[model samples]
Target chain A: MSLDTAEVRAERAERSGSRAYLSLFKALGRGWIRDRSQIFFTILLPLMFMVLLASVFGSGDTAASRIVAVGDVAVLDGADPDAFTVVEAFDLDEALAMMRDGDADAAVVQDGATVRIYPSATNSTSGAIAEGKLSALVDDVNVEVLSAAAPGEPVLETEVEEADGGALRPIQYLAPGILAWGVAISGVFGAAGTIVDWKRDKLLRRLRLTPASVRTFLGAKVSVNLVVAVGQTAVFLAVAALGFGLQLSAWTWFAVPLVLLGTLAFLAIGVVIGGIAQTSPAAAGLSNLVTMPMAFVSGAFYPLALSPEWVQAISYLSPMRYLNEALQSVVVYGEPPSAVLPQIGFLAAFAAIVALVSWKTFKFDEL
Target chain B: MDAAIEVADLRKTYRGRRTGEIRAVDGVSFRVERGEFFGILGPNGAGKTTTLEIVEGLRKPDSGTVRLLGRSPWPHSPELTGRLGVQLQASAFFEFLTAREQIETFAELYGATKSRAAEMLDLVGLAEHANVRCEKLSGGQQQRLSIACALVGDPELVFLDEPTAALDPQARRNLWDLMRSINAEGRTVVLTTHYMEEAEALCDRVAIMDAGKIRAVGTPAGFVRDLDAPTKVTVAAGQLSGERVRELAAGETVNADETAVVFETRDPRGLLTALASDGALEGLSVRTANLEDVFLHVTGREWRG
Candidate 1:
């Protein structure tokens, strides 16, 4: 079709725009790859820390074995000479408390005639196995005494009670933490820091000279970052489930979205931290400082129930905690985002606060 | 035709936190005619830049009115900016963009961006490095490229601040050729520099500015003529008498020492006849006074500073 002069001019303008956009992309892509080490620290490193650390620190292997401190050595009074050292002597309540505190993986709660193992009902086999070992230890000591005094002397052995399955697997524990981290990273790194860096580079100044609205620029960045964050979160969830046999329930549609929303919440926190910082170094540091304590206290690596009461109280204020709790409720507890809407509300509030502060405090030159 | 630039009673005070008010430009006033190669000659910190900024629309004066092409340049009218060009003394560009790309980007700013990007590149003798990044260009090339940027919009008036202030002799000569060619096209050029020789050679008319105001303004010949007339002077050492040198100087005593002497007078023939009588007018030189002498006569100092 033949075009008018105005149409021809418009076409040329469009072509020029396309060329400019391509040039911008090429430079940006090269710069991103060249600064790979920085990207590692800024993007991949924190998430790796979240996943690997949760795996290493949250395993339940040792949780199946009991370590009950023998108090007063009263039961070993008669067999002290012949028995093995460090035999896990059993006391019912103490053993139960040991297993509950996770200090003792399994506990031999011994009475006069019967021995009881109080592991979580989750791992009943571990309790039985632990009891068998304790009974064998007791019989072995008696056999030693009898064999020493009279050759071929017989010993009596009896069965005992066992508790349930041990606490939980590593992947099972880590799913929520990873989910929380993904949310926080999305909000902070994707939203606040990206905008702040652009502003600092005077890229914002160049863009401002154009006719594009501020809202449009911001919307484009957020949209890109959010889309990428979703993909990243999906990849991590898939990996954890497939590799570690983590029972990630795609059960309810709300579960993953809940986790994702939690991720977005913390991402907002990251955005604020990163955006508020004038330089990249400052942004990275501020985000990290907020992330580390949030990770530790908010049950990203451990249960909040395990932390100090005061720490648990502080976790209520932490957006990471809300994100973690919110995700854990969905991914582990089989709850929906609406069921934990209070938590979602808190996390959303945190994100809103951070975003507002970032918007206000952020400047192109810090001037 | 409207005057290219008009500034009346322009003043600019830089308010300092600790040092209080420092007046950078003080009630400076001047008019630049269309097609006039007006020169602003002054030493550093003489408010030359401040006055230029007011005209260029980069700055706002405290109290006076500044009209560029009959419009206020304070808010920087695009109509003015599009038709006017500037070569800032310390302008810089991205090092990564090739010289060609740099020119292309600037050219795209205007609608009828003369496809002369390459022609201009060839004009500046940078055709070979049209694809070379700005960082790789030599200092002179960079400055010329800056001049090329000003030339891009086909502006009617140009503001050149020390265009050749730091260039070497050859580069300065090359730039002078370009400036003459541009001036030959009848475009008004307002330039600031400390080089008196350059002003004398290139400027049609100059304002010898000092202390934030024009001390004198005229064509090169008019300025020199304004100096007291000394159409001729003679100095001879072969057999010159000390009395003869003093006698020739009559009014103010022309320079006299043991070996040589100097003379200045309203009438050269009578003075020469007097010296001839003493047989001491062996080597005499008669010539019109130049700008340097006129400036020294007017400003009472070396032109270099």
Candidate 2:
């Protein structure tokens, strides 16, 4: 009879353990959804970044460059009206001041036949484009003068062809990077801050007294995070497609799995931070210290091709880089799912390594 | 049948950067019988919490053997977990969860039904406040809610650590009644508290602990009786003159102030009868040794808590 009772108890424990896992999942998910601040930081903040960046650098139609023309130069008449928005300046100093104040991208001073152009130092990219446009216009004027001298002479022409078969707009690349960053922030900060708070509040100690297994507890946490990740992906893609004119292909569906993998990688890092940090503030600070710089270096805000070689090399160290690259491949570049296998491999390995570290450091009781 | 809890020579040491080595629990041993309302009473830093936590399997003692319901509690014995309920000194709940949600979650963790959770809330007189978030609950209410969550599992053994600490007198009294009812259900209760009156009122057996060790363990009445201390009887000083005081004091110690005359005697009935015959019972007051006096006698110091 005693043996039978023990068997019955064991069976009951097993049944309850499974039920506990489900309950824990539901409870955690509900808690996360109800927290107003967490929702803002993890979801709304990234979506806001997407909207802000897409508005500033989005679309195929580039804004005409603003230039301060110091004097009435005949060459200005030959410039492409659509490419330049000329603002008249009384003197060279005024033009230079306008360029300094960022009111203009470039300043053109026509001194007789020789015209000198000064690009704005602060706004280098647009300034360089403006300078190139003005230089081409001056070359066209010179060619017109030379053609009258030598009538019917053939001129050297240059034609441009896109290597990728089409122009990939900045917004197309930026949307995926921003989406990856959102996943990272949600995974890392959510995991780290929650763990530290739970530890400090003695919730973890309370949990230690329960019959629930660690596997069940972590399984619940990961499930809730994954569900939230899926929702985040959906909202991000919908806004990017409908509101921001971000094009999507059939391969974009692959972003779901990639985002989930990336979330796991970041969550593993979060677990490590949570295990190490003794306070919530410390966890937040550490998470920011890790993720903020990684966002830039991993090309979440800009392209890696524009960065120096050393920076691009360092980007290899950030898991966000792999996530961004994988997302960009499927979402922006329209590559097949198989093209992201290497990035998936890297994320999986990173998560595994950091998870081991977290396991080593995590303590159920403060004592 | 197995004892509900058996702890043997438990030792735990903490190394602090400034305090050096602190022996939190050193060579502590005790047993709690089935259905026993046992209390470990001590002042702050007396190792009561460390000892209780070790027994609850929340912390691993540096060296000890603890058995809960006939199985070792260390290394996380799952079979023993469902049989034991623990209410930690600090009450922590899932953030933003209502009282009902917190208890239900605990119930699920223990494999108990949600109805059992609701019943526990009612048992603790928190049924009406079930919808309030746990953080918004008053201190006493939170404590009661924690206790409810602890009992939701319906375990045979319950561990309560300073459950009534910081509560107002009325709340403390209410919690005391709640504790008594829990024990009345035949569950073995191991309570660690610094409140002498609390232990004296609720515990069947009390262990006076100080300096990381148990000074003595016995029923409250047994300890006080074995103390062999005298009871005091006092009367107005003007009612008894110096000559009368000398005559009345036969073999007991007599002390007289300008306001009162006091006598300490082992036989309180004899002294009271003599005072009554002398018509000296005016402004009379009788004082007997309680658990606090027992603690002072055993530990050779006044009780700090």
Candidate 3:
């Protein structure tokens, strides 16, 4: 066969994508650390809160030390004496009295049919231990349980583990709340605000004139946002586990994507806000219009169960609600995604549509 | 000859939802031969920017065609984009960036730029201030920086819209030198200005645009000569009547302004001597035809100042 060759005249297309991605990473990574005040608000403060609260609230997974009787109460009323402890009444009264003083781990006093159940909820571990131990001596015993610990934490963390359904740390109920809040603040506020600043700075316009593709630009931003959010989440997860001993180790896989989806959804929202805003102030205004009501009304800061019907209904419109709910269900109740897949799908669908709108509305100029 | 850039019957009208229609650029047409420094001069809101934007492939015309290097600019794809440089009118800059950083950044935008950003700064005479932030620079310095950005890609066609708008005298001269140097390198320059003096100084040829239409196009001298009443004969004369001045000229006579009677003429000596001997004129001086006089005669606007 005769040797024949065809020459190729390749035009420049691949460079656009590579250059655009590099710019995106540079923008996101630098933007994250560059503003020291923002870093503290978005990263450090939230991380500290997650760790401290998770540690203090999540320590309910324990079996207690052997029991000692109070000064007045001699023994268990049951005929089986083996179950009873015969400690002196003076120390028992002193111990029973210690419930108020934080000396005794827990104490029970005779009251009516309605017994006062208290461990220091302030001391979560102790509260859990106190509640668990009282149940063991429930029938025929008039009991007043008192706690010296504050509402958020207990010294002996036990009731959650031996509770009827499953053992869940308080942080389990709280992780989703924190993650959703972080994503909303960081993703929506971060992305939208940054875009506005970039436009104002002419950095974005400069990039638009370049060969950078839209897909590459957006993908890089999302990647950078996801990376920052993942780092923040890692800090939160670490704080929750190590600080409060709130174990979310079981549902790591479910948690990962749940967190990712929340971040993706908000980041897309940020793009939409930034794209549509005429100025940086306008972008901030846009974020405030959405974020303030969300931070207060959504379950990010507290349970929305007690909120008015309309308030709860309003939360349904919020992306935060779905994300927080999804996270809480997985971490707190160990509920699978199927139960909240509809909400996830809704969020994903909203994100897709918003992403498209952002792409469309985002002008290289102020158009 | 195949012009490097060609346009035919280009028209553009902007539509507002409530305000209805405003025709920014009415049907306009012109062409530029290869390696020509062409200037389009028009007053603000006279569709100068719109015309330049359309030709640069930045905006679409309502009706007509623009072919850049024998290619329609409407699609404005990257293949066509890389071949030209555009400095949009009143385009904002990233003030925080140093001049050198600004040049390097723009250079990176081009797929493979062999342009020496340092050389461009040197050409603009901004090498010493390369490290200074753009915002700290004077108005003239910024204008020079804008020019440097436009030339960073070693572009074949450069569209400089009001390139010297805010420049000081010295800066204008520096820019004029840079522009001639770029032309000497054989790059086609299409610029916009309201400065008749600048058009005369910088352009190889000039196209005077008015209210979205190109009124005339030729060399600077030709454009002035092509005006309806192209000639001027000034005299330190008593205020003469509109009719008494008519018989003094080769073509016709008209009032130059409040105190001057400008009579259109092929030969000013004939008209001047007649008035001089008759004592109808005094302090007589024949002025060479200029683009400003041409603009005033044609468009009825004092353009040079």
Candidate 4:
């Protein structure tokens, strides 16, 4: 075909748009990889958080808690010894001191028929976990006392049940949430910081001078970050499987689309912050304010069901919560694709709305 | 040939944090002919950059219209922007990308080839620094890289805002020649700068802006000639005392200082003849008045701010 032909010109025009998209994506990826700080924060920091959280919450092989018992051994007669290592203290003061000094996870004090557990609130996560275990043990001891009193009078029969899909280890439960958290970090912080930097450097002004639309530029950014998110998921899952013997359900493949949608949602959040902020530092602060709270309330570090009812209600507003729930249902519960459709739909709508808002607020010029 | 750019009654105002309203570009208008080298010359904050930006479609005028290639630039930015090249007044590119990569990206944005980008790099004398990251380049090199990006599209019209503001003397001269060559190839070049010499050296016509308005518009020599200022003659480390000074030139202005003796005269031949007869022609230099002298004549020597 002649170079001046209409067909050739149209082809060239089409190719150039895609070429610009690809070129921008590749350049952004290369720049991100070359900057060690960006890599550490976007990719490595999330993994580090995962590792730290898993080590703390998923190390189920270790002793559950260390309990200082301040009474005779009769009160703990029916409690499981393997669950918690019990220490004997002659007085309640000594037991409370042990708990305060960090020598023990909790102090169990008994006065006649009144039994109380003291777990320091300073270390909230461990304290809550230990207090829960202690309360369950105390209930077990009460059941034993009642059983002894009424041998065959049919005390209420209780049975323990797990979730629909067989039991899952803490690591298995946390892997998907942590992966979603990584995607959120890359989406929210990475996209916002990049936009803010571009605005500050007049790069947006330069781009505005070109024929490329704002959609194309932002599309390239989101595409590159999605690639990073996929790689992040794969690496984290691989590490989990290799180190902790994680067993993913057959429906685990559904997490890919879920993660991508989650990435878009988080990236929209970043775009909004970047558009609203005038400076890079302000963008950073705003992104943290957004993602940090969502990280906690959205079931990234813990299960949403474990939080209070009001907090769980609020988690519905966090895109991360939908991502975590959908990913966990696939990777841990072995739920079918239909099970996550609502979550996927919500995430898609959330991403679209936020992206629209961001676009409306974004300024191509300094004004 | 039709005009490449036509901006009429262009105005833009901004709200300052403490200064209230700032009329960045107040009722500025100019026309750039096809393939001509045009310039907007002014001091800092004189709204030259704002005018260029409005013409380039990077900004919108409050009440005026801009036409590039006979189409409105504002409402149809993408359509016009595809055929226009723009280099901003500030450094703007991917910080981590090499100069070559940055240029290639810009070329692709305009549906051009990487070979074209490389050619632009060569044209700007930046081929040697193609692989160097933008942040690592010297200020002059970065400025040149921006120029290469602007030209990578082989656009019919290119807008350069302070393209040589950060360059060294040699680089600035080289860029001027490069711009001239580009214009010679049937491309209109519009530039803005505070340096009058840059405008005089490169522009076919220049518009002098001050306080957000165009004060005068003409050819470089025309601007000087329009002022009707006299030719300047200086005698370095020499003086013509009163007796000889009166005979030097009858109706000319004379100013003498410790370092030099100066004369502004419309009659150079008569003054030269008198000086030669008096044997007081040592260390003499004569030149026509330039744009700077014209500017001082029109705007006065007071600092703009």
What is chain B's TM-score across the candidates, in the order shown?
0.86, 0.97, 0.80, 0.93
Q: Is the docking of candidate 4 incorrect, acceptable, medium or high quality?
A: medium
Off by over 4 Å in 3: A1-12, A23-175, A194-224, A231-260, A271-276, A329-343, A357-365, B90-101, B113-115, B126-143, B228-289, B301-305
DockQ: the better of candidates 1 and 2: 2
Ranking by DockQ: 2, 4, 3, 1
lDDT for each residue of candidate 1 in A1-367, tens digit (9 for 90 to 100): 7656977767765665554444444433333344455346435754586567665665434433544644443333443332222335445576566566545545544465444444434345555555555566667666776889997666566565542233456666677676666566545654446655565533443332222223433444454445555555666666667766666544434545655555556656665666567777777678768777777778877777778998898888887787676666666656555678898788677667866775677543331
lDDT of 2 by residue, B1-305 (tens): 99988889999999989999999998999899999999999999999998988888878899979999999876775667878888888897888899999999999898788899999999999999999988899999999999998898889999999999999999999999999999999999999999989998999999889999999999999998999989988898898778878877776799998899889888889889989998888899999999989989999998889
- How well does candidate 2 match the true structure in TM-score terms? 0.94
The TM-score, computed over Cα atoms with residue i paired to residue i, of candidate 4 is: 0.86
* DockQ of each candidate, alpha-carbon based: 0.09, 0.70, 0.14, 0.63
Instruction: Tell me the deviation in Å of residue B221 in model 4.
Output: 1.2
Query: Across residues A1-367, which tens digit of lDDT does each residue of candidate 3 receive?
Result: 5543332213235656576477456644654565675677678767765666556544334334223344333224441444322333355456555455554445544344444444543445565665665565663232223342344444443343356256544666667787778778888888887777766654444344444544665677678777787777777767666766665635555766777787888888888888878787898889878776886678776668867888898888888888888877776666777877977897788788887887787775453
Show model 2 residue runs off by greater than 4 Å: A1-14, A58-61, A162-165, B234-239, B249-251, B254-261, B273-284
Answer with 2 or 4, whichever has the higher DockQ. Answer: 2
Q: Which prediction has more favorable lDDT, 1 or 2? A: 2
Off by more than 4 A, model 4:
A1-12, A59-64, A67-81, A84-96, A106-164, A211-215, B15-21, B74-83, B236-242, B249-251, B257-260, B272-288, B300-305
Best by lDDT: 2
Ranking by lDDT: 2, 4, 3, 1
Model 1 chain B lowest lDDT segment of ten: B105-114
Query: Worst lDDT window (10 residues) for model 3 chain A?
Result: A3-12
In terms of TM-score, the best-performing candidate is: 2
Better of 2 and 4 by TM-score: 2
Candidate 4 lDDT tens digits, A1-367: 3347778767765666677788888888888778887778756776787678888876644566777888774566667777777889999889878767777877777777777888855555566777888787777777877899989877676688876555667787678788888888888888788878877678877887787776677678778888888877877777777877778789877778888889889988998888888887898899889888888889888877788898888889989898988998888778898998999999999999998998787775652
TM-score of chain B of 1: 0.86
Q: Is candidate 1 or candidate 4 better by TM-score?
A: 4
